[model samples]
Target chain A: MPISPPFRMEAMNNQSSEIIYTYAGPRTASDTGPFVKTRLMIREFIDARELIIRLFIRNFSSKYRQSVLGIVWAFIIPIITVGMFMVMGNAGVINVQGLKAPYAVYAIIGTTFFNLFTAGLTACTGSIVQAGSMIVKINFPRIALVFSSSLMGIVDTAVRLILIAAAFIVYRTAPHPVGVLIGFLSLIPLFILTLGLGLFFSLVAAILRDLINIIPFATMGLMLLTPVLYPIDNSSALGVVTQYNPLHYLINFPRDMVLYGSSELTTGYIVSAIISCIVLIAGWQFFYMAQTKIAERV
Target chain B: MADSVITVDGVSKKFSKSVRHMMLYGTLDLTAGSFGIPLARNRLRRGEFWALRDINFEIKRGEAVGLIGANGAGKSTMLKLLNGIYMPDLGKISIRGRIGALIEVGAGFHPMLSGRENIYINGSILGMKTAEITRQLDSIIDFAGIEEFIDSPVRHYSSGMYVRLGFAIIAHCRPEILLIDEVLAVGDARFRRKCLDHLKQLKENGVTFVIVSHNMQTIDGIATKGIFFDHGSLRYCGTPGEAISHYEMKMLGNDAPFPETLIEGSTKPGSLRLVKYFKDYGTHDIRFEDVRITNAQGEPSESFASFDAATLKVTVASPSETKTRMYCSFINEDMTVCMGAYMDISLKTGIQTIKIKFDPIQLTTGRYMVSLRLYDEYLTNPYANGHFGYFSVMKGGCVETPGTNTPYCWRTPEVTIA
Candidate 1:
């Protein structure tokens, strides 16, 4: 092999003798330097993917073990939330003239995709503090915690999608074939956005635990800000706000991808994709920097 | 065994007591650090203290190094630094190979998960792949002796079962570099023997180890080298025996080489505490005429608990009011005092009784000799001074008692539970 142990190690006299090791202060600036840090972060993620899967299995299995509800909690909560919105819509408290899809199909699809972002972000934000014992004691890439929880989000979102399919069966209608393809594809950018936001917020959550209490409450409000339960059109101020909201494009694109085949690739969709990439980069940077001190902080 | 597996250089790490200030200043440090704007990190900000200071050391393949220190002496911090749990503020540390640290047993075990599941998670956290862990699954269960309860949620497992399972997974990982913090024994005698044997077997297979435990027997047996730290600095490094002696001598503040009769055959390594008896052999330049022991409540007691604070009162008689040094040797019935603490004093011509108090006696439960010895100014001539009669150190009743090693008064502040 061309790679025979590194340069400095070979220069050493022999194995039996004491090999002196050295450490220096604040090492990141010595690098090119952020480039190396980014590369290492990606390398760590790939190298630790097995560990991530292990943690994911541990979390996913333990989450539903022995409880009566079991995996039903994944579907039940979204079912209830969508059920509440449909109840209001049926009572004439809300209007649906601008929408073409059934409220059951529309609401379930929107909430399922949005749940990927909301649940993934919440779990990711809380994962660091939740694994404080391991973070302080074991030496491994801390990103595994975020990755595992985000994977759980994927699993949960998949289960919630089944609820959407079950709704389609109940309604006796089929999803637009092209829409289903794009709808599944849309999950990718949503996950990237969730992971990015999760990495940054998780660090802050480890420090100021008030973020833990604030996240679930905040995500509930964020659902309104996105076009999850409502259709985005040019009418109300809420619609205007939704017009500017990138999540409206991100979440709606996927939901419309499955509910109907004609999910317009708006200029906003391109912007949302760009934003997701930005969040991922920023989150990875912040998480890596904060990691050096997390053992002490947690 | 083929490579230099670990390197640490000029490393220093500081910790802040206040979380709020740490978050604020940490942000400042991170930003200032990224742009090459060196924030004066050397200076301790408010509520910040140096946990590890400009320390440097290294380990080659298959060498076992033991870390010894008083509480808050940064032994655990150094271990954390080596493990990459906490990066040093000043220096860099590079550890090659898959590092498996039993720094705290069950470090990542989810209590809600079953014993079987936790094994996978813990093994993976130690850097094992799923296929590797699966191959070892039966062995892990067999080592832990938890086959029947493998499917039971770990929350339902007894504490002994919990630690056993944790250690079993760690031992099976076969890490090339192992860093263990004070996990000498987790269960009864059978389990203790099993754990020690596993460590011995691992050591024989050419694994490098950095162990931090106050258990001298473990150090004397398993560790080839010992790193003695005091307040975050590398104070002494030598053979395990010499390191223990040096550490003990430093703690007592006197390093008078013991008379040959004292420690000749006393260095036997094992669980058996080799209690030593010193023959009275010095011509009297100064003499210890009387001595007394009292507990913290001022009760004159013959025995003290391991955690009890007590006092030693000594009266010295001398020919002249001359410059002299006084040494008190605190000995346990099982193990000899690794070293004695000697105090410098000017004696009164005839007799002056001095009262010295020990707040929270740092000894495991056993009979002890708070032996008083006197010396000439330069510590040449020595006398028995006086000895506290066979007062027992009763079992310390505290949550800090681990019951296997000298139960903690130090390192207790830094307990990171899994």
Candidate 2:
């Protein structure tokens, strides 16, 4: 009898050939019908949480790994920036007028909050691109990459906030009880806003890599436009600009509640917070719509 | 019952080249006097071209399929679509199970993290739960063969070690559908064999697999079905043998010319001629007729047996005026060089030639290319080189399976005893 050909080997080789031809095709709209199933989001969220923790650890370790001071450097830089702002403001080189709290305390709080917002935003914008190979090779929620990078920034922000509070204690400034409450409460809106903006910008950055260059300039312009250095009241153009700036509410609402014991949220704060929610939803919608194109575009 | 676990229908993916080019133009548009109208016209004229044209396929559960193509044949783009990294621009794809891919091993691994840490991180990326990773962690470590260095930063691991760890984690991920892309080619021989064996085990367990490889031997060895892609389209989709033949045909066109006449020799003998050939050591200035073939028993024969001990003796002539440095190479029928040897012998005038002999050729039964080359003392420059001749080592002794009509056995029937 003729020896039978190696059936298993033949089968394997044939299967591989089929796969080569299988992936070739043009872009068609994906069927989003399956997405209506509620269980998908729950699974995605659980997966995202794991990814977030992993990313947070990686970001933390990688940032500090080769540095001389390691993790201590995280606390040192923020302290220096806060101290520089304090010294400059107190010596009359930088003026802080029309504020209810001491200038150094107010500046520290503003810098801490703003730093968190900008760092999260900037890091999230590059996350998708930096993780380009992963995004393109594996099947996972692309949103995880953006959210995880933002989470890393949040961890840094939390560390800096703790250091600021310790400095306040050392300086003999009596802690306001409301400040603690505001700190926890503010994270909700801040997270919602950052997640939305982060996802949107990450998508944009992946498609148009040059946006990476534009992001820093935009954030700097935004910092100058907001009242991070000086407090804004109703009488000034700066106040009007701050009222319109969504990030201003994220920063000032917590500051006001913490330092000044303001229980009532300002009308501008309420309006901007609503806008922030809308912006976030809109960003998510935009990302959801554009995500299908990301693999091709990137 | 639908055996197809993954179905792709009329899929086409298109990308706009002008859109990518216009990114550069935007900076230029900043300086140009008129940016609006030209940019608008360019955008309008800039249309889309499909990277993947109309294609359709159904992959059954447990099937191991191979994707074969030249560069830019849309093989990678297809893997991306299957992984859900890209939605097809025009087609619909339905997948039934979770996909675990090793498209680029260590794609998401952080260099600063320890190998143990990266396993957790990579496992999560592959959609494995923490509990699952914990349970399989030991297996991953064992498979990777880096237990001693698991805690060291992955940045310190060699590239082979990194790939092993990455692949080990992926293998233990227990994906229902697996997509692999050319990752095996990066590892060494032993590691490659380990991965192939692991993949075979996985296939036996009914896991569906999609693989892309440029190595034809690998495709022949592992794939159950095959697809041939050309210029962003599926040129053929069927059996692996045919696909491999197609690929080989494409490759051979550039290197091997079809013989005009069956007996006609190569026009430029330098490409085909064999000047000097030798194997092993000791014997020198030997002739072809004196070269004896024998079984493991050391009995001399014209045709040697398969999987048996054998020896070959060859003689090299070092003409007085010619350079004495020479190199010999042995190649299989498929034109792959199996092994080689090099030596230099500077001879004075009046010497006719040198005889070289090789004994106990440790080779399996097959046709082989015995080629030779003469070069300078440095061995960098070549003077003359090509295949000297071809020889066959038979599959068995003459007394057994006598006068068999098997396709390859016809040439040696004369040696069989009644």
Candidate 3:
């Protein structure tokens, strides 16, 4: 098996080559052509695996170059958000209710899980445009940017998990090991949803460029609407919106599965999982349609 | 043909001049394309024009081909297409082997990363394995001559250091094919000569190249074949010597902007083809007509000896009264301005003759073009300009100059007994 790099596909001799024969304008088969053939895309992913990991490390390492706190900066956001909510609950500004664990622990875990989605979506969506200099001059598998940028979420999640572990130790409460395992598994749906939306928006952002401004703004908005800061079982019109929101299920389902062993959120989680899968598949198709022309635009 | 690595067939790429319009039209094009209803293939939408059209060629493995053309002739676009930076709208370009392209300066290095770290990042982007970069890391640092500062962020490095590091990383990639755009001036004269020598050495090692440059002499030395493009169309394909001559002739001609159709593929070696493009002076402004160069005897000549006096007789005609300052610039073949003289002369409404003389033609054995640029009194906005003609200093006893080919003798100062 030859481990070719990205852009190396099956040649004419190997899988009939992308171009089995030469072509001029309007080759007879162009209209019927797959926007991006699945086999070719899969091969590209395989070839680009090394590049993806390298880029991920580059992004992760360069991200905190001059910061004084460095990787510790990852813990500050969740801790700050949890602290603010705890203070609000004490002041009687809003009732903190329905979290099965201690409120501080509940908010910390929720922020940890929610960060996965926000970080991944932001990374994936902005990767191509941020690396616009490399994109325009060199030709490599562009999808590498999508995967590599999204990988930053996994890195951030891992870093923040240490903070969560520290939180559990301080609280002197342990969740069911099997339920925690289920929580870990939920990362699949969460990652898929983030990656899918990212791939789709990358092309859109490349065109409008200003569209990326909305991604972070929108993610911040989604945080408040979802169960990141508060409990999910609300009794107002907010409950109606939260009930239908897929992100609501994604944020709380696994956290609930681990902290309480079970919650009335199984169906919502499954539905969110299915929707994420569809989004991932469809998003890749859309990314493929735009990927070839993206260099010109960027 | 069997060993060919690049095949570009009937490729045409169009670009919109306006960015907002490009975004809009690109959306419309993609939306229409999704319906399997092909959009208009042969029409230019608003603000849209063809950057390249009907470009066709092939590059066999191990062949170093040079691309020569004037600015905006689509040489850069052709290289970009081959590098897969731009997709062809009308045809297919199949390229084999791992490729490296050095398009612009700074080689896209991340500002926040150290030179050492950016080497790995840029190398990975260029498709090199981490293992490969590790293996070549010492050599790259050594070649760039920045080992001491390699650990510091490249953002703080001098502009020359940045270019050196950028070039060094790409040079170490060991790609099978290299596509270089015209940003080759990375450092001082000595560094440029070293880079040129390195490029020649790379060619000897069986790496293929399709480089675009305005330096005909560099192309002549490095390329086995040359492709000449004029206004997005391939005008000629042949030996580097002939294509360079063809390009020079077109520069001097007075024909239609660029002939729609071109005589494609090789002409005889060192042969010249003149393509005259004359822009109408139109209802206003000045006319630079009839330029004559004379050697020592005052007879018209195109070749001169070193340190020989020469005079340029320019006949300028203006329809309306205009006070024009005449500037005679000596330009090298690569179009680098060497030395120039300014004359604060006023032109009458009709034809007036002006003579500017070079006391000693202080130049070496090389080709040089005398550009007769007519400027307004402030010497800012050029009203009319063209190359008067070219002259050659055939032989010389002088030592080679440092920064240019224009000859000057070496001077040795007397050493005191201090």
* lDDT of model number 3: 0.75
Put the candidates in DockQ order, highest first: 1, 2, 3
lDDT of each: 0.74, 0.66, 0.75
Ten contiguous residues minimizing lDDT sum, candidate 3 chain B: B409-418
Q: Output DockQ, candidate 2.
A: 0.27
| B-chain TM-score, candidate 1 | 0.63
Q: A248-268 in candidate 3: lDDT tens per residue?
A: 888788888778777688899
lDDT by residue for model 1 (B18-80), tens: 878877776676556445575665778888988888887778877899999877999999998
The C-alpha stretches of model 2 lying farther than 4 A from their native spots are A1-43, A75-95, A263-265, B15-19, B22-49, B255-418
* lDDT tens digits by residue: candidate 2, A1-298: 1111212333433332222112222222231365532343445566578867777777777887768876575677666776776777678875666666666677777777887888888898998889877777776767777778888777777777776687677666754786768655775677678778888888778767888889889987988788777766657787777667878877887877778667354676777677779878777655654565565555
Model 1, residue A162: distance off in Å is 2.6
CA RMSD per model (angstroms): 13.3, 10.0, 11.0
Instruction: Write the residue-wise lDDT of candidate 3 on B1-418 in tens digits.
Output: 5677888888888888999888997677656644556676667788988998988888887799999988999999888888777778777787766678898756558788889988888888787888988988888887788989999988999988887888887887766688988767557676677677677777776778998987665676678999999999999998876787677666644541422222232242321121121244322278665666677787878767667787777767878777777667766655677667777777778887677777677665456666666778886656776653346655332433333554454222111110
Q: List candidate 3 segments past 4 Å from native.
A: A1-36, A91-93, B32-37, B250-418
Query: List-wise, what DockQ does each model earn?
Result: 0.30, 0.27, 0.23
Q: Which predicted model would earn the best TM-score? A: 3
Clashing pairs in 3: A11-A17, B253-B276, B253-B277, B254-B276, B254-B277, B254-B278, B255-B276, B255-B277, B364-B407
